[model samples]
Target chain A: MQPVAPSLRRKPTVMSLLARFAWLPLCFVLVGCHIDMYDQPKYRPNRPSDFFEDGRSMRPPVENTVAMGSFEADSALFTGRLNGELAVDLPMELTADLLERGQTRYEAFCAPCHGLAGDGNGVIAYRGPLQVPTLHNDRLRTVAIGYYFDVITNGINRMYSYAHRIPPEDRWAVAAYVRALQLSQNVDADTLTAEERALLGGP
Target chain B: MSAQIFSRNANAILLVSIAAIVLLIVGIISALIGLYLSPWYTGVGDAIEQPVPFSHKHHVDQLMIDCRYCHSTVERVAHAGIPSTDTCMSCHSQIWTNSPLLQPVRDSYQTGEPVLWNRVYDLPDFVYFNHSVHVAKGIGCASCHGRIDQQHLTAKAQPLYMGWCLGCHRAPEEHIRPRDEVFNMAYEPQMMPIADRLALVQEYQIPVDGRLTHCYTCHR
Candidate 1:
């Protein structure tokens, strides 16, 4: 069957003209303007709001509730202390894997600031105003392994805290690595293993 | 008389309208698909303005400074952190203290306020990526960042879409490198033979499976 002629069809009225604009809104709709949860209403940290009584988005911890994973069973491992005194021994076994992990972590974290040899000559130290101390100093050599851990976890004078940067296990590994670095610098020929002594061109 | 006018050249008009409608529909569909897939929205290789005008091309390429010198916490933290104003003062305090190029940095130092750097590469809020994890797992900075040493003002080097992310996550062994080379921006994979590189991946213990391809690997 033939379609109706154009003249026979109804002419576009003001209503039809208005209906032609329906696609304008449909274009926006088709573009997917619906808000994903990613863009949902949110309070960023440090932003103040009238909704909260404190006018702060950041909330303080409850009076007595403990944080998850806050309870560390072994203070020696986490804080480098045993019986309220700095521990001399490592809490974990000294293995090649641990040292390898330590070396990688040290290169990534400390090498830029402390130098690979712990000689206080890292690129930042030589160039920056901050004076980094050597790990092989007489005082540091005498300090307990836990003392190093404490300084790294809490950050001593002129240093920032690595608590957020380094994990407890990695921190211990770093302490062990530092100990190894200290031992390497000031080796007594009398105390060397016979195999090691041979490598030093000794009889 | 009206019917005769309407009938005149009606076949030609119908054919033209039909063709025009088909072309419009095809164009719309193609445009929608292109918007989703194309690099136009990704802003790949487009230079972004930052507050300090710091140039990785100058620092990494010319000065030959290691990537970790500035982004020091990359291997230990989630974010490949921007160096602090104090970190900048380390060198610029003496060298270029009077230069106008470093005015913002000097201003930030004097006021004890952070120089708010304009971020070039941004992921969706839902995608939770950790720099430390990727660094430790043996993926080199070059794999995702492209040749950043060549960039004067950094831009998003890749599409950063879900499919683009999945492409690498699917076969990470292809991207994983030696741990020492993670911060080596100019490092090329072909430096070592293919067999040696593959062996390095296995030695590094990078999972050769879909563990990283899982949604939670990135989202969580």
Candidate 2:
């Protein structure tokens, strides 16, 4: 090869490099615009409750928010409907079928903490750290059906609402069963009649 | 010199063209195969057969019985569970006593065993699905489960996947109705117009965000 003159010789400098790669800047701009279209914050499902609303009450009302049925002045009967306005009517006689249904519901929803025999020594209460109240106590016996229902539905202190798990009718049935448990254990000796004593296999 | 430059340029262009053509062919073939085989591509299907041939078509369509009659827990539980043999015996013992079709159910009742009906419209095990909540909110069975009443063999009609559920959960008002009309599609239009329904969904703060895609909601 023949040697060229020094004045005619050229080199690949920064200006030449820029000229060769001029499309890079435009390419980056195009890609950036495409990504920006979809860069907005996405929608999230199952967001946790915002707990910082100090002005608004954290819990629902006590009376209107009973677990099962609330007593209404208009009708003299306990209604199972969610918002039905009906009066509380105590049953004249407790039925076996009602007790059976109540037992089933209680076992399914409450027995984990409130033991099968209405004692507070359930698996969750004994094994777990929580202290559940025994239904066999005198105080619990005096508690009204509506009050029991309210506690189950709204939860008193540490307990969460079983309303989502157990239906409204079943809650009433469970309450009825709790009442039956209280009656069976706390029956007064004075109230026992000759027929009752005979039925009880007494002298 | 001009001829040499023309030949080099032509050779480079030809090489690039061949590479581009090969990539195009491979991409097209793979895309087609993916579309056919992948559930992610085409959604879920219910081609798998159950142990017993339980026909929703016969039960729901021909007989005009409701879906809730058999899958009784839909309104109250997370699952719209398969009926126990006892539930079947409630009607089957008197109605289809001698029919050959009732043999499996009769056998189940006699043996104290339940039929393990194959789930067709099952979501991923992680999803916490409550039939009652959906039913209570006025979502129709047909909305996600498809036209199940028309399906004789109960094939899964829709892809009951996360995206599929989020589509409605994010904008429930559009699909919601009064408690009674929750299962009734016909009652939707009469209850509220689509625009009004969408507005109500927005107003009630119905979750539309895909955040429900969290692992615990469905998986747990």
Candidate 3:
């Protein structure tokens, strides 16, 4: 049999080698094309109106001050309506029912911040630098029920709103309890009758 | 003689090629059958039996009690919470005072612990289902939860897939009604017609086509 020609054999070998090398760039091009298409940043539309007016993305606008419409002067429902004006009517005497409801509401909501004795020494108030005012202080005592309701609903400077956690009626109940605390601490000595004065060991 | 050797080589190659083709065909068929028909290829389809044989049918159907009576937080919170022991005791304490069924309630109260009720209608951990939104909509509890009122023991009545949720959310206005009638199964719209409902759904731009099928929608 005739021996195979070296040139012919080399031609087939070289062609196979060239064909193998040609796939390198092709493979890279395929991978690069896919990466370019899929890995690119997607286009998103810019719509300023989608953002909240308060600049907060998630939260609704904070109503820092009470609006006039929210207050219900004679509505009997002490629970202040949401986004309504704050109303106030001071009864001369706090009833037992009012005090009881107030106390229950206080323990649930305020006691966590304003300590059991109405001192500013609540666990959270004491632990944090934010000075939650004591109920014994004249600043808190002189504030109207409406003012207290506003603070509870809207939250004071450092405090967060308890509106979502406590119902509207409960805020009024808490305000009533704060009044009771003030009265208990700062009672008028002259208002007592002779029998009451004698019981108090007063002249 | 050379031709014979070449023929033998060709025959051998042909035999090998035929064997390889047969193997490939068999492999392809096996894969196709496994993909479409073989049940073993399916993952975790077994229904787990719960601890207590609590019947949704008895409570929801026989007693005619609403789903919210037990899962009360469905109207207010993200979860349609399992009823607290006190909630069970509210009825069980008086109604089934002597039954062995009340033992679980008594046990929970005595231990001062909640019954770790086995979850029946569990979605994938990724889905963020807000029971309040659904309850607030006119979607009846039965719409997705299936005929839970008819079951003796409440197994998962619905598959609760993404397609299942999108089927309603895509056209929520069609399902919408007065807020008060949100949970009412027998709610009938008096003021709004079907066209109005459809329009409201469009106006709200309710998500259709299941495009909001993002990982974050359900999962954190």
Output the number of the TM-score-best candidate.
1
Native contact fraction of candidate 3? 0.00
TM-score of 1: 0.65
| Model 3, position A171: C-alpha lDDT score | 68
Residue-level lDDT tens digits of model 2 in B66-173: 465456568776667566676566445445477787788888788754455554553433345777777766677877766676676766667554666766655566
Summarize candidate 2's per-residue lDDT along A1-203 as a digit string, tens digits: 34579888888899999999999999988877644322323212212224524221223246546544444433223333223422143432457877786876676456656777787765556644557777887667665566666666667665655554455566677888888777876787679887887787756
Better of 1 and 2 by TM-score: 1
- Across all candidates, what is each one's fraction of true contacts kept? 0.11, 0.00, 0.00
What is candidate 3's lDDT per residue for B1-220, written digit by digit as tens? 3433355488889999999999999999998966754334322233446545678766656555556546645767887766666666544543456768668777877775445565555554445688776665555675666555666765555556576676565556556665444544445444579887766555545565565565566656
Q: What is the DockQ of each candidate?
A: 0.14, 0.02, 0.02
Ranking of all predicted structures according to TM-score, beginning with the best and ending with the worst = 1, 2, 3
Alpha-carbon interface RMSD of model 1? 6.2
Model 2: residues >4 Å from true position, as ranges?
A: A1-203, B1-48, B185-191, B199-205, B208-220
Report the C-alpha lDDT of model 1 over A1-203, residue by residue, as the tens digit.
Answer: 46879999998999999998978988887898555755435654334456877564557577765567754646698778898899898899999878887776676567766888999887666655657788888999998889978987887776756665577888888888888888888899889889999998867
lDDT of 1 by residue, B1-220 (tens): 2345567689999999999999999999999989876777768888888876778898777665677656767876677867767667656654566789899999988975556666677666677778888888778888889998998988878877788778767766567677778878877766777787778767877677768677788875
Which candidate do you rate higher for TM-score, 1 or 3? 1
Please tell me how candidate 1 rates in CAPRI terms: incorrect
